[model samples]
Target: MSDTLRIVLIVASVLCLLFMLRKISQSKVRIDDAIFWIVGAFVLVIISIFPQIPSWCCDLLGIQTPVNFLFLFMIFILLVKLFYMTIRVSQLESKVKELSQRYALDHMDDEVKQDEK
Candidate 1:
């Protein structure tokens, strides 16, 4: 990769890391989610600084080019993250449904008791 591109990537990664930290400080992002983003940003910065690392990795994995390897790696990471988020959302939805049902039942019982009185 060109030096200019590497510098840009490094700057962007640093900015993202800073943004994530700010969000965490403001309680806008959960620690668990922030951890993944923070780590991703760090990895990007490291990769940008040491472009040879990706080339080495590609060679080790028998990949043709560093860029292709990076694309594949990023896609894999995103897919894993998406899967985790899907599971979390599903669990949250189930909990919300259960809570709403319980609340409705309690409300109905209260109304029935008032009517009886």
Candidate 2:
């Protein structure tokens, strides 16, 4: 990558890191979720500073280009994150449904008792 491009990437990564930290501080983002983004931004800054690391990874993996390797790695990470988020959402939905059902049953029981009295 060109020096200019590397500098741009580093600046962007730093911006992203700052944004994540700000969001965490504001409670806009959960710490667990922010951790992934923070780590990703740090990795981006490191790779931008040491472009050779990606190249070395590409060579080790027999990949043709550093850019391709980075894209592939990023896609894999995003997919894993997506899968975990899906599971978490499903669990939350289930809990909500269960709570709703319990609440309805409790209310119905109270109404029935009042009717009997």
lDDT of 1 at 81: 93
Q: Which residue pairs collide, candidate 2?
A: none
Runs of candidate 2 exceeding 4 Å displacement: none
**Highest-lDDT candidate:** 1
- Candidate 2, residues 1-117, lDDT tens digits: the string is 678878988898889999998998899999988888888889988988899999999999999988898889889999999999999999999999999999999999999999999
- TM-score of every prediction relative to native: 0.91, 0.86
Q: Residue 13, candidate 2: how far off, in angstroms?
A: 1.8
Tens digits of per-residue lDDT for model 1 on 9-97?
Answer: 88998999899989989999999889898899899889988999999999999999888888988999999999999999999999999
lDDT of 1: 0.91
How many angstroms is residue 56 displaced in model 1 relative to the true structure, after the best TM-score fit?
1.0
Model 1 TM-score on a 0 to 1 scale: 0.91
